[model samples]
Target: MQGRSIPAPNDWAAQFWSPIVGAEAQATRETVAMYDMTALKRLEVTGPGAAAFLERLCTGKVAKSVGSVTYTLLLDHDGGIRSDITVARLARDRFQVGANGNLDLDWFSRHLPADGTVQVRDITPGTCCIGLWGPLARKVLQPLTDEDFSNEGLKYFRAKRAYIGSVPVTAMRLSYVGELGWELYTTADQGLKLWDTLWQAAKPLGGVIAGRGAFNSLRLEKGYRSFGTDMTYEHDPYEAGVGFAVKLDKDDFIGKAALQRRKSEVRRKLTCLTIDDPHSVVMGKEPVYDGGRAVGYVTSAAYGYTIGKGIAYAWLPAELAVPGTPVRIGYFDQRIEAVVAEEPLFDPTMSRLRG
Candidate 1:
């Protein structure tokens, strides 16, 4: 998190993380399989005090029992989401934090203690990650590791040590897939080797290599919030309806007070909307209207293939967030028709996690 200049769009983020392939090929669709966020500075927190520091600073508990990949929000004293990160608990003494935005990396760096019992290091250059998703994901991955994924305890937010070739790895049941998937995390030197290894194992399952665009579509369809986009420092967990990730009952933590107060005082809330017309898509920052008055603005909008329509997340007034509320989203010259609906246009019951 050295405040390097932001990377230009379509840069070689994947190559930096997984250096097995040539830069040109890594930047392309064959090996990368998705958008390259490898440019995001990686930070490693380890040693005796890391867990205690995280428990006080982050929304989720970072203790040993919950040593799995978890979604957490870093907040200021005022309870806004400064960064939404995925915490990968590698072991009792080590953990990794993956963030979507660079600013959060700086935020975490500034807060570390000077005594050094808890240490933080930038490991972006040394780590590589690839996500295997879709229905056949687990079946495709079973051959690469010796652990039994079919074991009942290999549930979501869980992980265990495994190996591919000679390199040690941590296979975590974490993904944006809304389906059964795993994130293969290992050293940078072995990144491409692991990717090629997995590709060979996964090809027989008819697995489609996923890209950033498709990954974004799948996540947004499930109403997952993207850091710096759909969610920001201005929004609290309560309004985002991610309260499960925030354990208010736990011992004191940062932003706990503000979150408790904001629970009932939220004026506008994040909710999902579907365009009445499938052909009409509502883009972000479009004005959302009720009658002649503009009540809210669209934060994230996309065409959902599963629901077969335009779906979006908007910060609508709490009263207007009802399931049947009629709203309109504006385009350049024409306004698109839409309605407010409960988020998660697909599988509200969360059935896909079991598949």
Candidate 2:
């Protein structure tokens, strides 16, 4: 994503003004910030067997009710993650699928029954998403829609259709950051309009527009897993530390048997690691050492701006995944003092997002 514009249409002004107000910390503490997420493409799936087809392809129980959004993973036949996705049931036979790229349409198509029980349409060119994330997200957004935006009215992980200043939107009560936020989706033509509407609301609420730099830091602080980085097809759900997303008791999905067997034999796990040295920087692929032996490596790393520490996630042997387990992170030639930390170091109780 280097040198690529974030598709913040007509956002040159905000990009220029970020230096003045958006230091990221402001968004985390008091107000809301908008992140351009058009790079993460969306797909539309429809037909008679759309729900059944998805159920067979994912690792979680996909809901068939309209306006419900479910977080599920598409796993390979061997139980390895192919992609992580959020499926929003738009109609009885129609669904909107969100993924990291447009190419996932091919994967969705390839899994379709030869008899044409499902249809996949790539909607990236015509649609886009903007993540309005932070503590004051509701405060900034509630006035634009007649629909309720309160925590009680709109529960987390739910989706609702509403008009935000005349722009059609599908708002999902979800955020990568552990804060009260929403990911709003709209047509590409109206993307800038929606951004401007929210931007105007943010001005008085002390919120500022944040860029991808702040976006990454916010998510890392929340311990949100990055699919390709934190996990790959090489690791199973149990090993990836996202077993909560897998439901084996549901009807048999593609990777059910493999995941069920491996649950009992899980050898490695993904755990958060914090470097005792606050200034130490550990990009991905840094080897972790337990005593003198090499064990696992960091897949995702960033500074926890809120916690005032450097955090990283590594795949370690299950025995070494415990919190407070002493270890050393090899950052370049230097060994930084580190230890295993329980997931979601920033908001373990998740009061902020739920509030």
Candidate 3:
């Protein structure tokens, strides 16, 4: 969100970005964008039972001290992820869990206890989310808000309340782009107004309106997992390279036992591979081979700007999962050679984030 002006979605914004402003237009090697996400819903769980319920339902540790947010996974009893969620602890007893898309209020309501202390609210329409990313994203956003961007405080996985052009907003200092950015959440009625204000402020910093396609490429470059694409209930956390989200040491959670049993039961693991031939593009579920024999399949593939090649995530057998292993990913009818690179194809050192 730097070095370019942010445009207010007027008749122009709705027309420019499509009826859905923040959604994806297409999914390709060069770009990964949002198509549709309303099938999933935004559900808010608050009250005394909120934290305790989330602790039992998710794969990550939700019991942070205060004002903390963490990426988590909702799993079935078998340890397979149902939906990836970002759990934000608003208070000791209140928390907000965000998912990909639609009607999740019903999804969470079905599991809540009949006890009146637990209140489930569907406030999707009342709230809106805008993401600011890119290498210069921080530079763009730093000047627009009055929050402390100090080194020791307000670091990653941290959230702070701030103002954007005088309107109240909750800025979560996180990014799917793997850069130091924030996801600004505010009221829906003022969504367009705030977007324009952010853009106006970020214009001098070179911020541009980041479409979903660009966001896709950014996340793919970071080797970040996408729900239902790279991860699903069919796959466990460990296999998807989301081991950090799962806390095996905890006493109990929905899939604790299953996760423990499958800790070492991984038949394949998530990996990053760069196309040997940049011209040859690989698509999802494309067969991956170790000299003709199928060892795995591409789960998510994209052309990364940072790496200057087609980098992707795949599920490969354990024998060929080590870093520096040679492999081939099939594209069209031909095979595109690749190497088993480390887990984050971009910013592996996390310098972009720390900066």
Candidate 4:
């Protein structure tokens, strides 16, 4: 499990573990791929006030039944996007929060109620995660355990406690790469065994151990936004292209009033651009020009191996965000031609993910 490694955003893991990222990216599309997602911050929220506390802070409904997962956002008072997180209700009084990083942990810790009815604990150090995804993900996993991994048995956005071989795991039916899969979690002591078990089972099925490089390319193709790279506190859910996660009809939550006021006033947006030339690519933070004037900058960019084009997400004026609007990205000495394209560039119908 070694190759050329690069520094990741988090200090605990490498940006990539393999040299050939394209092959890994292809594996995720054509077959199964295992990703080391241990760098993802994991948190445990428990106590009598767990559901109420989370519902107050999250924009989406968090007070759901056990084994349910909700993709939600943590917003600031000004309706700015703080973090996009997933809240999994493990029990009546317990939740597993899949969050960004230390900043999210700090945000949750700072907002704890004075009555001490809720407890937030960092669980990253004690837990590890493996993201097994692709068309054959269920095939690779089903034989290892008795638990039903079928679409009907463990549906999307759901969580179930199960065992993979001898390793106890909590499997969440979700995918960052827009593929059919589950994020399998286990204790640190069982991490090695879990990885080995999956790898051995998937070997005959043509599964590859992928890295962050392929993961980034896959997610961008799916139009998934990374918290810090594609958005920040300055952007709102609408402008960030994640307004679907915001439920204004729900009861009072953080930034509810501000979001209501800002909903109809969006002036800018995180727009998707596709390079005209399939070979041309930008490395992000490059200036984007509308006509002759620079109007925005690229936030995240990757070569869409699956789509046979270059993809970049950039911040642009609302008028320039329309599909088919032409733009140019300044990459060092060259200005590459691109156009505002409808996302996600791949799997717009999400049939692959649902299967």
> Which runs in model 1 stand beyond 4 Å of their true positions?
1-41, 151-153, 165-167
Candidate 1 lDDT over 278-304, as tens digits, reads: 556465888888887888888877555
Which candidate number has the best TM-score?
4
Per-model TM-score on C-alpha atoms = 0.86, 0.92, 0.85, 0.94
Q: Put down candidate 4 lDDT per residue, 12-72, tens digits, no spaces.
A: 2132233377778888888899999998999999999989999999999989899999999
Which candidate order results from sorting by lDDT in descending order? 4, 2, 1, 3
lDDT of 2 by residue, 176-261 (tens): 87788899999999999999999999888877777765766667778889988999889998888788889888898887887877
**Total backbone clashes of model 1?**
0
Backbone clash tally (model 4): 0
TM-score of 1: 0.86
List the candidates ranked by TM-score, beginning with the highest: 4, 2, 1, 3
Those runs of model 2 whose alpha carbons end farther than 4 Å from true positions after fitting are: 1-22
For model 3, how does the per-residue alpha-carbon lDDT over 195-268 read when each residue is reduced to its tens digit? 77777766665445556555666688778888888888898888888888888777588888988899988888
Which candidate number has the best lDDT? 4
